[model samples]
Target: MKTFKVVVTDWEFENLQYEEAVLQDKRIELVKAQCRTEEEMIKVCRDADALINQYAPISKKVIDALENCKVITRYGVGVNTIDLEAAAYKGICVANVPDYCMDEVADHALALLLSWTRKVTLANAYIKEDKWDFKVTRPIYRLRGRTLGLVGFGKIPQSLAEKVKPLGLEVIAYDPYCPKETADEFGVLLVSLEALCEQADIISVHTPLTEGTKGMISKAQFDVMKEEALIINTSRGPVIDEEALIEALQNKKIAGAALDVVEEEPIRSDHPFLEMENVILTPHAAWYSEEAEKEMRSKAAMGVADVLLHQQYPKYLVNKEVKETTRLNESLDQERYALLTK
Candidate 1:
């Protein structure tokens, strides 16, 4: 029996103990490589049957070289780093683990919201500096009876709404894809984007980063928000313009912002947002939990197995077109194709 070759980028391979169980299945061979540069990624993915990438840029140049690759699986939910159009053009199936850390992210967003509203970080800094009168510099607010606006009412936002409902928050959500009935099910009022901005006491983003969503919140949007409202972003960083957010915070246009992600990963040390008292920043850890990591790794490995064994389709396919192309190709057996199509 010929073994199928699977190449995983170094980042995903790191701390992935579940690969051992996968390697035990003799039909598949897992090869790990750390591709720091585009050239290295192209070279490593050249002959791979399936590639599992994490934070590696699969540009057009790299995808063009993968003639043997039938599928590309991301270890996490976000695919902003990968070029989806290029992958689609090459007929490569792109899969991601979209449901793994939904609750973790919602919890993290709530944590940030509470921390910012209560000035937890600021209070800690004040004590370290021997300033007992921190209350004079930074005041705290109660979470009860506040209007919480969710920019996108996806799974994370839905979970967040449920969690905060007990705290007496009036949740309003804006998501064109979600139905008004669904929002009503969660006791959340569905509102327009502009209305959400103007009426919300706290606004949190939970949408994906796509052409329509990129820079959706900019200077003009911020200008309409209430000066007392706080902003929280656990979603894609670029969805909200970082420059506009910084200016808003600097000029006291809004109360504060708690960001788990920024326009740039590993934000520069000299970034102006880092120096502001009204801004709270975290290093993209909103989706991180030990249990979530285990689930993500297990689900990602299963997705790879499903593709290679020509079994069922992945639960979360980034490119739906690839499934159609794969079905037409006759490379997968009739039974497998039938199962997928059905």
Candidate 2:
């Protein structure tokens, strides 16, 4: 059995028992390291044959430094921190666990939406302050009969729409990529982005970060939303302009917001959003249920195993072109060896 060195970064060594169990059967030795700086990452990853990274930046410099890296398995769905183009150029296959957390994130989005609409957090605060008079407190609206605007009608949005529909809420979705028939099948109104903003009683974002979607929701988008509309974002933080969101929240341009992500993670203590009672903030944990975490880790490990075994491309490859190139290279190498031997 050929032993390979796999480096696991940004993981607590004691907590990754599942990863250890997977590695035990693969003849893969695991080197656990926590990187705090770019320099540390480059240094630690220099001799690794494969990397299992979570929240660590695999920059071009680090990729170039890795002399023997065959695969990079991102521990979660998002690979924004890694330089994917560079990894592809270096002939390193990148893989991510995309499906494990979809349900968790959708559930979190619904939880946030309900919390904001029902004033659960605010009511808790009021009770703590000894303001128990129900008549004097502000009224909370029931979610039934409200319009929910979904920014992207992807798998997570589709799942959420199904859950929301039975609750008597109308679902509207805006996705340039989705066809009208697809939306109709889910009982969702296929509306324009502008229409969603103007008409929805609650808006939730579930789009991936791309050039067109980066900072997609800015001042103009926020200005068009109903003043009573509650915005919820459990997707990437940069999708919404943080400055614009803060301004809108401060001025009461929208009713309230529940954010499971922020532009700057572990948001600074002095951040203005933290001071607002109308805003409910969670530390980017929408995708982090215990079951989801375990599944994600195991699936990511499977991706690494598939690549190391030189098997057919894994189902969760983000870059299909990379796998094609790898297969082509292997075929050419076989042809050359056969020619020399014959």
Candidate 3:
């Protein structure tokens, strides 16, 4: 009858009502904190049996300091904040809500793409400045028969392809790992990254933040892009080298860019993108909607509750390679638990 403690390491949610309600029936003490640094994480999470995280550094130092932690569940799809390898080595489970906000992000990305393609935002700005001349916004091209290059063909891009299909855009993708058959289902043709860059009228990035993908869209990629090509990045910012993008935009190497995420959060006042009319910027808010937030919070808390309470198998295990060694599976004695790793 030991009561386990689940701590929220960091969050931007206005309240913890959904998480608290989800864990109410379990014998868990839910604690919330706004930990920014590893020292703060180590101090607040030392005794936690499970943790729910968002944007907090769960580093090797913080992991080694834990006395009895078992699981770390993330609020969103990305687990870049948590040290997955360190947690796995410590026999802890790392799970995430991988499917939430797919639709919302796809919609936002499409909106950004359209804003650039149709000059919607720019035209609106032009009208507001007391300029009523329609001829001011010129050179608008038709979307039909134009190639839309998707940098990743994952869930969000799949949704994006489906939504953008009837818009007369020819969708192509550049995911070295995406199955060609998967792309074919959405009428998207998988191409080499270079080919996508060379052919696309619009390039929308949807890749994750991995070491291999940190600067996947750097100078080399930008060099091959068409002069009229526009890029949209709703994914992680560092994926496109900021310096290279600025250079490209300044030199007119590419037409423009629409970005939801920047390489650095809360871009500084003097950032070059601010002075560029060809660029559109929105705070990293692609994965927002009231429904998505509630789903993410509750599902994240439920993941913690499931592992701590020994409920069904964790539905969204991130570090699945460590499933066999996870403390939660090792401690279970039920014959049914023998199939846990499967």
List TM-scores for all candidates, in order.
0.92, 0.92, 0.94
Q: What lDDT does candidate 2 reach at residue 220?
A: 91
What TM-score should be assigned to candidate 2? 0.92
**Each candidate: RMSD:** 4.1, 6.5, 4.1
Q: After superposition, which runs of candidate 2 have C-alpha atoms over 4 Å from their true positions?
A: 12-14, 135-137, 328-342
Q: Which residue runs of candidate 3 sit more than 4 Å off their true CA positions?
A: 327-342
Alpha carbon deviation, residue 26, candidate 3 (Å): 5.7
lDDT of 1 at 234: 96
Candidate models: Cα lDDT each: 0.82, 0.83, 0.87
Encode model 3's per-residue lDDT on 61-178: one tens digit a residue. Answer: 9999999988899988888998889998887888888777999999999999888878888889989999888676677889888989999999999999999988999999989899
Superposed Cα deviation of residue 59, candidate 3 (Å): 0.8
lDDT of 1 by residue, 130-208 (tens): 8887664455667788899999998899999999988899999899999888998999999899999998999999999
**Model 2 worst lDDT run, 10 consecutive residues:** 332-341
